[model samples]
Target: MAIHRSDSGRAPDTRELAKLARSARQGDTEAFLELIESLKGALYRTARTILRNDEDCADALQDTIVGAYQAIRSLREPAHVQTWLYRILINACNTILQKRQRQSLPGTLPEPAADSPVYQDVELREAIDRLEEPLRLVVVLVYLEDMRIADAAAILGISEGAAKMRLKRSKAQLRSWLAPADMGRERSS
Candidate 1:
């Protein structure tokens, strides 16, 4: 399937989503699997960016897929499936964060696999992890995932202005976090 760019001018096409939603709502297992296949990478990346741990990210993605499948019938607008799935993923991440916060183990969490390319640049990843959850979510969805600001706002349950504001702040924070000597290398080069 060809991927059409989103409004942000980077994301892929969401046009086929309506058919996937219809089949999923009808309890078509193959269709549901197709839906998952289309979204799983983005969902996992979003979760990983937010949670910063492989186990938590995997758990969040799993929960999101299950929740999406179960809740497909309640979705009124089939064309908005991408946003709907993102919302579920964000919710699942938030739930996991809240649980981690309550357990007081947030900071102690370890990074994911060293072999993964995502871990290649430790300083950048560390900088991203230091951001507040809200800003981090916005950065991941918009910059990394290439989602449009309006669609991200919808998925994040925030106003468009709020999404833009968050994106600005996230960029500023990333800049600030990278200001230290070693960390500054990435941006300068």
Candidate 2:
């Protein structure tokens, strides 16, 4: 026999998630575990967008899980749990990125902008990797994750207007980078 969960290619029910959040906040381990399972795939993608390394993604995820478990009780609004968890994951990913920057010697070569395993468009991913963290993050959350603007902003801990502005900036950058004439100039200069 096979069991299908709401995670089987369907959006989870908000009410069900709210109830789970409430239970998790009340110190129910199983509920929190369930919540994590349902959200892990999206969370991992978000981490990948920032860190670009599987090992770093793993570390960020581990940190996020621990951090969330410890702080669940303080999540005041159960309905906002998904974005809350996302925020924690983003913070963890950023922490790992900062540590990597500090550990690397100044003369060491930067890692290549890898072709994203998750997206078929190699050039797009490369362009995205070239973008600053704020713009790249908004693109990944809003476009790659298929998340709404407001929710993406919430997860980024920014106002919705700021998220929109970053998204616009990213689009302009991608357009400029991908243009044929711009590419020639970029290669030459």
Candidate 3:
């Protein structure tokens, strides 16, 4: 279901979202489903960015949904439902990563998801894949997801200043990786 965007086209009304959350907390299944439906795109992007594979992304999303439903009553701020959902998603992704780390060979990474919708550009995808977790997550939240630094920081449980620093560092790293090709193009031209 398409969320109803306001005239500004920013996000769905926070008041509406908060109402859904409050209803969901009170055992309204339809409201809970609606809330999840609205956030499905973002949840997928977040999981795909962190896990880098469809299977793990699916797992993380499932875990997040279940966890969020079970703990909906614990949510302190109804208006911050998006942030709360993202926090649960991030934790689910991290848990999957930790498990994968334990099972994988030393120094090896998980295979990239085939035909990933988000990272269609091969070069950019590889560069983002090479970034460390913190920087990579910041890039995903701030750049790919187009979230504010403060919002990204809240999801990542970091200070706003730290989120800004990570965004800067991620940009510099991406530029370093992508600049060589640009330089080659310029030289050829």
Candidate 4:
């Protein structure tokens, strides 16, 4: 059975997830360790989005593990584990941000996701970095990670309407920043 089944796969194996979540809750360290693999990429992407530094993303990931471990027992369902994990990750990122703010460091571009050509563009990454925190986060969760808007809103602890509003605003901002020449091309076409 696939670990992180995507939207189009046959129904996910709930029994496998239940066993994993149960083991993790029962102090099985290895099961807990294995469960993290499904989330590592998305976690890295979101952390990178928020911190824009590889080291900071690593720190945030570490914090996320610790926080998730401490709180996993409270989680009520295995099916929503990824969403629950994302909420923990966002908290960890916020903690790292607080530390960075106190130290007064300039943000830098993180290594982009290796799987996507779109992430390869330095200018696009720079444009994303210029967005406000809420808008940037919405873009990362929705556009970059291909998560549902509802999932993004849940992970961000916001209403769905609020998430939609941020996405709408961010789209306008990104259009202005990344595609100035497209306007002329559109008219000509």
Give the per-residue lDDT digits (tens) of candidate 3, residues 120-150.
6888988898899899989988777667888
Quickly count the clashes in candidate 3: 0
Q: Each candidate: what lDDT? A: 0.79, 0.84, 0.85, 0.79
Write the residue-wise lDDT of candidate 2 on 1-189 in tens digits.
Answer: 111134434446656777888999999998988888877877888888788788898999999999999999999999988889899998999899889998999898766655655577888778888899899899988887777899999998899999999999999999999888766778888
Candidate 3 structure, TM-score to reference: 0.85
**What is the Cα-based lDDT of residue 37 in candidate 2?**
80
- What is the per-residue lDDT of model 1 for residues 83-184, given as tens digits with 9 covering 90 to 100? 999888888998998898888764575554333344447887767777887888888788778788998899889999999999889888888777776765
| TM-scores for candidates 1 onward, in order | 0.79, 0.84, 0.85, 0.79
Model 3 worst lDDT window (10 residues): 1-10
- Candidate 1 ranges beyond 4 A from true positions: 1-12, 105-122, 179-189
Report the C-alpha lDDT of model 4 over 163-183, residue by residue, as the tens digit. Answer: 999999998998888877778
Number of clashes recorded per candidate? 1, 0, 0, 0
Which has the better TM-score: candidate 3, or candidate 4? Answer: 3
Candidate 1 overall Cα lDDT vs. reference? 0.79
Ranking by TM-score: 3, 2, 1, 4
Cα RMSD of all models vs. native, in order, equals 4.9, 4.6, 3.1, 4.1
